[model samples]
Target chain A: MAEPGREIPKPTPETQHFWDGCKQGELLLQTCKSCDHTYFPPRPFCPDCGHREVAVVKATGRARLFSYIINHLPTPGFEVPFAIAVVELDEGPRMMANILECEQTPEALVLDMPLEVTFQPVSDDISLPQFKPASQSTGSGSA
Target chain B: MGQKTVAIVGAAETTELGKIPHMSQIQLHADAALNALADAGLTIKDIDGVATAAHNPVELAHYLGITPTWADGTSVGGCSFMLHVRHAMAAIEAGLCTTVLITHGESGRSWVGRHGPSLFPSELQMQFERPFGVSRPPNMFTIPVLRYMKDHDLSVETLAMVSVIQREWAAKNPRASFKDPITVDDVLNSKMIAYPFRLLMCCLVTDGGGALILTKADRAKDFPTKPVYILGSGESVESPMISQMADFTSSRAFKVSGTKAFETSGISHADVDHLMIYDAFAHLPIYGLEDLGFVKPGEAGDFIAERNTAPGGTLPLNTNGGGLSYMHSGMYGMYALQEGVRQMRGIAPAQVEGAEISVVHGVGGMFSASGTIVLTNSE
Candidate 1:
């Protein structure tokens, strides 16, 4: 029998665009047409104003390390002692991801450290959005 | 606030806690229900209303041969029972039901007759969080502690102290899963399940259940046991995703629920002689203390470290050893409520001397929801 793999998200109508954007290497966010409120894990309507009309906009893919834990338990398709983090996007929304390209230790993964989004395709349809320490350069587009 | 309206006449845990491989999940619920009924000197036929979490109220009511007029299956998370108690009070007052039975049971360790994990592929958590390797409560619930520590200058040693003190309380309780005294060094040196959270700092994964019976205050005296009156209760919810919590250092749900309960109860903090803050993890009580307004933000760590919540301290918090040192059967709110009722009745294993009022606060999910209940022995 094949070993179990990490969970892959199946996109609904509301979140298909977000997943599609990830596949194309563009991070997408939803902005309320009436209130200009941008949110994540997309839905058709705006969470703030409940406005059905909304626009899909590309995100800068920049974020900050808000909080995290270095999980020692071996999860499927994940290396043991990996950093499972909650990163606050520069756009003011937060999301969970694995912190990569950095030491999975408290001393190395400082809180509020600048980070940038990176995509790793887990399946043909899903490109999981993850994070790593930001480079010195500013305003680079999504990976 | 003016007068007592509802009272809990009976509260009991399953005949055995920690582990019961023979009993399935629903069987744990039934055992607790039967025990609580026996405690109150009533049978299933007397229950007009039913409420539970993790299982449908309809199944529980029917299995117990009850045809309840009212039923609620509010499964927000671990704190669902606290919300049920709050709702039962309102239901009894509004004449929706004369007597309500609230139950909680989980075969967390045994996993007997429990359903396998449900897969919702398109769910928000599955899409965003799970794919990134965030699974189970330890990783998800402990995610916010690092930020809380950074913002408040809390040391890891203080976090370890939470487990050490709670273990001291556990030593006094004969039923506690762990009774040996442990030191902060012991906690820090314990197996690291997740960063900043050692095995000792996490709650026990046990199989157990508990039930409570509530009715109008006027009819409470007819029960076989002493009645613990419901003075006030509150409940609220926040973002389902732990990552989207408004602030990592505090829970908005806890603040909202605690404030509402305190306001409705019309009782000052000083009036609370005993307290139970659901401690699924060590950092939870810290968050519970500060968010519940018992202490200012950034002070709960210091307050707990100073042993204010320890045995013989000014505030007897988690007199039942809490989830950290006591038994945590997945949905732990029922056990917390049971401890509150015990303290109010002055029969707790580690009873607080001269205890008059007790506040039981609980959190569901990964800071996803909260419920607060205040019980008083006085009318």
Candidate 2:
């Protein structure tokens, strides 16, 4: 069934493990064995060298806020005045997530602020990797 | 290589813009194509090439009853029509076909028969972007503008000036959707769709389409309309995802394509008499100006704030009011190209008197793709 407000991702064959890892409150990143490069958003092979020999390693869930926007428009799944942020993980990849547990303003959501990943279970099989200020305690417990 | 010569002989927009409840998405394409054909004094049988974005070339060709020898359907986004013009020029130069008709139409506001591209479950956008609650273009595009503001010291007031300058041009255009003068405070205080972008700063939700007829420059005089010669053209795509942009401050695709167009045209910044940088959002023109080498990085805001791009200014930009005040039917490149043709032909409603050369640049996704075209009236 489709979620009401926000768009949900249906995990594919190549992406099932990543979603499963999220449900367990873990962040998985794909690393190329040949080039030793780490990448995000889950792919089948190494995007760096086109190598089939790839491995999924657990990330440290550590990142720094790169950029963000406080979207005031009313979206279906999310409330208005939410901070949609792009954070560069310490492992050398970037991804988008909601900067929860912080004021959705330019002052509070400072750039390069330390961040850590937290999972929000949207469905039985899906758990989204959301982020919050690293100074704050981990909010959501592992399912 | 010698100058590759191609000319746009005919250009026309859909009959009604802004609110056209009568036409479907495909019908807009047909409407523009037929209008262009009539403008060029040619029949459907005369066109040997067909190219379009948003709709299938096969569908448009069949609908117009033209069996083109060459067809190009390069849909990169709003700038897709610019790529179509480039491809059509190359095809005509290579003797693949002649008399190419490039069309664009979209029910962006009405959403009638608006069949969007189908992204599979495994697609990058579906897997990554959608999951993050990135609902639409407004939210997705603001991700970069906010960063740009921080890096460039661009205040919200400076950004609002972009719309103010464009509205100044729109006031001169009789057909402009929003001709009334708008102030910077008006723009800043409007409903905030996203951070730093207000309702006035965003492109208007409009329903319309436009078409262009192109042929070799040598044969351009044979057509009824004055040929707007294609001096140079370039198109490029940096990434499909906005988050994966090369940088937040600038668009790599805009730089790549704009540099190529300038180099091919062999014209300096001084030679440009007019300009049309697609203003889907206020920040786009800022990026377009900087990336296209017209202005230095972080200077576009002040350039507009100083009233340099308004009518009678040294550089007349978005003389058709741009997407901000003009009709924006989703794919805005076609309208940009049409304005270039109008200026070159000296027939623009907001005519920049004695204008000789015009540069039309466009952005596809949120700085994800770009296409640039250089047009001139001189042989």
lDDT of 2 by residue, B194-306 (tens): 77678998899889989999998998899888878999988998877777786889999999999999999999999999999999899898999999999999999999888
lDDT of 2 at B308: 90
What DockQ does each prediction reach against the true complex? 0.84, 0.66
lDDT of 2 by residue, A1-143 (tens): 22466777788888999999998999999999999989877887987789989999999898888888778877777777888888778887888888878888878888778888888877778888888888556421211
Number of the top-ranking candidate, with lDDT as the measure? 1
Worst 10 residues of 2 chain B by lDDT: B116-125
C-alpha TM-scores of all predictions: 0.97, 0.95
Off by over 4 Å in 1: A1-4, A139-143, B116-122
- Collision pairs in model 1: none
Q: Candidate 1 residues B1-379, lDDT tens each?
A: 6357999998999999998999998899999999999999998999999999888788899889989889998888899999999999999999999999998878999999887431112268887888878888898899999999999999999999899999999998999999999999999998999998899999999999999999999988888887899998889999778888889999999999999999989999988899899999999999999998989999998899899999989988888888987899888899999999999898999999879899999999889999999999886
Q: Assess each prediction's global lDDT (C-alpha) against the native.
A: 0.89, 0.86
